[model samples]
Target: MQKREALEFDILFVGAGPANLASAIHLQRLLKRHNATAANPLEPSIAVIEKGRYAGAHLLSGALLDPRALDEFFPDYRAKGCPVEATVSKESIWFLQSKRKFAVPFIPEPFSNKNSLIVSLSRLGAWMAEQAENEGVQLFDNTAASAPFMENGKLTGIITDDKGIGKDGNSKTNFEPGLLLKAKAIVIGEGSDGSLTRQLSMHFPSISAAQRYETGVKETWEIPEERITAGEVHHTFGFPLESDVYGGGWLYAFSPTLVSVGCISSVGHDSPVCDPHLNLQRFKLHPLIANILKSGKMVESGARTITSGGLDAMPPLCGPGYLLTGESAGMVNMQRHKGIHLAMKSGTIAAETLFEALLHNDFSTGRLKSSEERFRNSWAWEELHAARNYRKAFDKGLYSGLVQAGLQLGIPGLSLKTTQLTLPGFTETPSFNPKKKKIALPVIPEFRADGMRTFSKERSLFSSGVMHEENQPCHLVIKREDIAEICLKKCKKEFANPCQHFCPAGVYEITTEPVPALKLNPSNCLHCKTCEIADPYGIITWTTPEGGGGPGYKLS
Candidate 1:
């Protein structure tokens, strides 16, 4: 083993996504203000380490920015050359039938993104990295933080993933041991299903409910000029999905030629065999969506899961020496279908709490808990409180969920009656239905990709620009071969893998002609981590790939 490098800081952040950048930037500002006013000024060191090759390589989202939090983060954002694709000017919602659609004139308050910006989250994240660096925050890209360091159920810091190791479980010539990053306070902002956050949970049982999630698959394309009006955000439900399935489709035409088309499906739905990626593909086949996307040229495609557990899913804000923020902390509010601003807000609150802790030279859980009060007192709390039951209402399916949503909207204090989800232990809720399991085995019609608007998974994965060192250990691991057998038994077939369905990247497939077993194409992964979240058997574990071995955001 090589002698690993060590680093120390007053504050350390893992994952350089929106939350990390936002919080670091806010902290810097606070530090600057304090230094200017205080007789005894102090300069605190701040550091951020990211798993992505660059800041935005792995950042993907439907990306409708509710600028409320962004405005607070950078009051003069537009002046800072922030990338705002277009200010939403028009919005529409529709309920679709197999061959028909009806426009609903009523735009929900959440979708009423009047001045909200339709922008690429990748662009926004990259921009924040630049801004954070300008504020003197140390930024390290292509560095993966593997796990948190916990001592007696308290976080002391993090340990980064080992580098330059070979597939044979031995160190190579260029081997480097993982770095130990110790800090007075640690901020976890690794986005959805963060690995370190999961690691910490092992030492300290989850303080809040485990998250319920919805997976989204999207394709970016340059649509025909005449068909789209820039800044138009259109959403639709029904069609493509069975009555029992909870899912929906969206189209964000942010420019005359640039548009995003996607589908989101509940991970805990009753249909275990239903394929979200296939559902997204089937969504484009609908006449209503087919018309707009038919003549477009494909640009990029990817998939990711969003937190839907709302306020109920959020874990405790702080541990002894650590605090959780962003999706890692379950800040995404389901009702509004927007978490970009919420992520920023959570980070801002964490920053304020950390600032106070810094001044007092205290890093205990009690001191950090102040951030939770500020968060609950902020508007984020009110919005989240109302949406607390949004995802839980979906337990009965889409129609019922919508009805409950309406009642919650129209009736005062309705959500106060919401109950906590009591999920199964050892394992959790299964996203698929056993009755429909075999029947839902993804009978994708002989639909061919036209290469313009429609493309195959291989083509889409290529567009995502993901690259992995094939000879290295597979980051996507199957811990229990017995789990595979159980999955096949559930599907009632030999060598049948459920992973092939939920993975939008088509990384897992069961090949019968050769030896009748699963095959992994790890290089094509989009880094969505859906396999880790939705696998019914709870056997698939997503570890950090070789540094910079995932998708590269191109728009390269």
Candidate 2:
């Protein structure tokens, strides 16, 4: 069965990140301001596809940039060469403690950033894919998307992965076949947990709620220009996470010798060994982050998964023909740990609802669901419904989630009743029951990777330049083909396997001398779907891996 090759488009856009490159440069500036006063002149064709081998190769972030949706659709985005890197000036907040740190005097207007810029969201998505290819938009970088081309029951575009398969799965005389892109409108912005947005959420299901996630784990240091300063921002939250474990840690600078650090757990944190990269190596051995990385070096590393369920865990922002902007549509807010300007304001409101469905040709789901009622009437929906209970108010722990974030920042109408206090990041993990009493796990304080201040995970997957071809087809699947007796007798008797501590690029090993199985080092993937979102028993999935392969993040 090798006879594919179709390629139309009126609009395609599937993850070139930064919300489909700000909806393909704001739908090419709203079709050049409505074809400069239409006299029946509505041009359509626009594309954007990227499965990253470029366009910020699997982009990662700690990226602070709230440039208000890039000053509302590239208002000369710093004169169009926009890759800011430093502007913040100074901001602070802290609380850590495994050695001491307290700071937090003010700076909590949703963790203020002052001027906000410190970026590298993979170099601001390779400079927003060069302003979405200078606004004409058809960009394709290593392309991926592998499915959701549906026909009668809607969608209509995207099918791209196949290419030279082989590790015994055959078809390898440089086999190609995998292109049936067609499109009348497709948009997806695949990011958090997105494998074609989880196979189109089983035919557009998602009546909101039930989407929670958080995994972060970044790095990118250099430090030592007199110990940091360019835009110096910081943010911390209690010590190595166990007040029932939600998490946080950051550092931003990007200049006083290039900073940007990380940690951000809570993928439903109960514990299947809660390791967000060993809680980012116990948040860099916090003596206030080891004296700001004592001498600093680690140039880059990555991990991701954070569509932190705000606005009640979003999902169906238009169906039928499709449209779900950034972070595949949760459009993160998490009380302002921020989502690249709410994913570039949901890519400029999915480019103003696909420019009125391309001036009335109507790409259906009720005319693209009025781009979700114009994103719930903008201001990125009042900053994600005023931080809608910020990540489920830390699932009721960390000091009752900092007293429900200090009463939703001193009662901003109680964050509109917190979307009924949501849940679902795999119900915060721990459940194989064994008589219900398990959790006590938090002791994780060991450290000694020291290839110059903590390194291993195979040297942070070789500084996260993660490569893979090893004769194709093994995009980390394991949907329980008895994954070695389910990782040796029920994940080693209830969670001891924890995918070798939630895989921040070590790619799950478990090999007891070729007897206990589950080896899979899928080219040490850093495409961070965090073992398919903290795999409890639901076997791991994370597809799409042969499109210029994962991680080459140039500074995450």
Candidate 3:
């Protein structure tokens, strides 16, 4: 490894997405206020690192519907150059059965607007990054942060793969070699279920792995002239065989020529059913969806891992010298399939909390925990809480059946009211149960030499005949006895089987076949690990390898 000079900063922000950018802006504003009033103006140096080549190039969204969080964070966002492609003119939910379609209107409380605006997240991210840079925040793209740097049980900075460096040592001094970033504090906005955040949570047992993830596979298409206009968004609950899965699909037409379509599934580590992409393809073939896309052409396709582990699944938001925000801390409203807004709100609150901590010269867990409280008090938390129980209802086959039923009645009011009324109560009592019967499988080492060697040499592996890339080598090893002990001691098979239905990659295979086995094709694995948490058996564990070994997407 090449040695290089270390850099110092007061705050090192990991990730350049909406969350990080929002925090950067808020921090600068707070500093300005502090400097204006205090005797000594504290100018805390801050830097933001983004793995993507550009700030928002990798940020994904399905035509963000009117984000109330945006209004709360930046009341003047529209006036301040936020781009709005088209205002949503029509919002309807559909329940489809083969060739028939049922449509109903949905109204989430307080968002009385039947028409919400559609936003281009790429443009939005760029704008936010620009604002951060103008406020003096250093931004570095294509810089991948792999782990948090720690000293005496406190976070200081991060270890990153310096992408700017060249082999011949002729690159810019700032990008010349491997270096440590020592900082007074670090804010992680590394997206839903980021590896470093997971590691940090592990270091602090108060945070549970259960508060983890969901997977989203989305594609953008160019709509034909005969189809719907820009400013229309559609959601569907009952597809051809709705009885089989717990997830649904969505279509958002941002422009007459552009539409975003996608699906989200619940998956666990031990599941052996459903591929997200395959589901999406099946969704497209649905009668209603087929007609919409009949004239449209596929433009972009990608996938995202989301944090849907809910309030109970949340990780510790703060620790000594470090703070976790956005998806890293499980701050997503899965019911709405929206996270960007929550991420931004959480980032803003985290920045404020940290700013206050700086004034007190305290960055300990006790002090940083204020961020978590702030988040809990915010509307984001309330919305997530409200939708929390709905996941079970969704799994109970309520979404597809009820949604379809409401549509058939042609009573949008009934459909909307039913969802609104039942959502909160359902969350109060999650009806989904796990399957109790246990199927014995032969004990196997968690880490197999054969699997490692195959993954290391080929860079691509197949399990159940699906191809996926293993960008990183495996670093976790477990004895077969350990697996047996975990199964015998800690396993509890639940009926909902979150992992089986949730994975976008369809990596887990859950069946009662003798020796319930999960065949991992690392290539198809998005590394979301919803399965790991769903595994009551504690059969799954994740480890880091040479950095930059996960999926590389053009627009994920």
Candidate 4:
């Protein structure tokens, strides 16, 4: 085992996203206020660790709408001069099916707006990071926090995966167990549930794994002169050919020649069965969408997970010496596809609560519980509550299907508001069964294609550039008959196969024949691991590939 020097700080924040950055800023301001009168004030020492090499590099490649809540966090955000493209000139929602469409004009409600500004998120994330640094927050990039450092039932800091040798041939560096950094408290803002957060949450039984999630696949396109333009954003329901699917698609214009389009779907739902990439391709081929992309060319495509667990799905916000914020605690509002704002607000609250607790030198759950109360009182909670209600109706397919049908009816005064009365409450009823049932698996055909000679053999297909290593062969002992039985059992228990719906690269196939069997198209696999999460059965296991193999993106 390798030993490394230990570092310490007053507070340690995980993740460098908007929420973490906002918290850093707010904490600085609070400390400054409290220490103004002290003869020898103790300044709060803070550190933020980011897995990515650059702040906001992961988010900047995409486009986002700037919410009004941004003003509450950064009053001079606009003046700071980030890469804001355009203020929304027009906003309209469409209930769409095939060639028919209905336009619904919704009035702005608190925390909800149709006319928000379009921004370059990559730039925005970097900007927030800079602001945090300017306020005396230390940042550690290219370093991942692997686990929380716990001592005597309190979170002190975190362990990191930071190991590299110097450029000189003789210089050598070895992997070291992360050093413990003692702090008064810690804040976990890790984006989504994974190995570390899962371990931490398990240690505290108050957190639940029932928090919901949805998969989002997005593609950016660069087209000709007449393709897409600024100020035009399109939302479509009842997508072409796949009218039975409950998910919706979007087309947002960034530059005159660049358009961002994608779809978001629930993880485990049947019907409207189609691959996300194929859906994007089909969406582009739609007469309405095609007309805009007539001369356009595909630029890039990516996928990410969205948390939809709502208020009921929230994890315990505070423990002995830690607070969970952002998506890590399930603060996303799926109804509006808004999470960034909520993440920022939650982080701010956590920081404020921590600052107060520090003043009294009380970091117990009693003092830190204020974070949860603040979250409930904020707009984030209200938005999540509404989204939870909307999802209840959405689950029955009544909300989206009826809205689409209503739009197609073309009644002059018809509007989504008119159907609001039909929306179901969160506690309405159980539309799905909790118990698993036995079902026959569909049979899939074998395609004997050379893996190396596959069409998608291009260098860009597999490398994420973030973490790329050579693939290694694995030798495992599992009976073939047992594997078959497990696969069949998984098909019955896990509703809505993830391989069929969420694969952005079209790697997995779900056959509708004799028995459902998953076919893997290794060549098209982007190594995104969505299939791994979507797999109710632990069938999809990943192994490191040959060095330097995988998709390499300009921006992810």
> What TM-score would every model get versus the actual structure?
0.93, 0.35, 0.74, 0.77
TM-score of 1: 0.93
- Model 4: lDDT equals 0.60
lDDT tens digits, residue span 43-120, model 1: 889999988889998888877898999888789889999888888878888888888899987886754678888988
Which candidate gets the maximum lDDT versus the true structure? 2
lDDT score at residue 347, model 2, on the 0-100 scale: 83
List the candidate numbers ranked by lDDT, top first. Answer: 2, 1, 3, 4
Q: Report the C-alpha lDDT of model 4 over 1-556, residue by residue, as the tens digit.
A: 4555678877888877777888888888778777898675657789987766677644522345546456776778778765677665555566666666777576234224356666655567788888889889998766566567777877777777534322231223453344555677788886755434655765676765465555666666677775556866776666543333446777777768877777665543222123454444555555767677665655555665566656666778888778888778887765565677787888889888988887877878789888878878987776666555444334456457456334423432233443433322111121333464634432322223222211121222333333432122221122456346654454445444545555665665667578666555554545344554455543554432322233434433
Better of 2 and 3 by TM-score: 3
**Ten-residue segment with the worst summed lDDT in candidate 4?**
451-460
TM-score leader: 1
lDDT value for model 2 = 0.79
RMSD in angstroms, all models?
2.8, 20.8, 8.9, 7.2
Order of the predicted models by TM-score, top scorer first:
1, 4, 3, 2
Supply candidate 1's per-residue lDDT for 451.
65
What C-alpha lDDT, on a 0 to 100 scale, does residue 8 get in candidate 3?
A: 95
Residue 515's lDDT in candidate 3 = 69
Give candidate 1 misplaced runs (Cα > 4 Å).
1-3, 412-418, 421-447, 487-496
Give the per-residue lDDT digits (tens) of candidate 3, residues 164-238.
Answer: 333343454544344577788888887765667756765676644455445566777776775887788787766
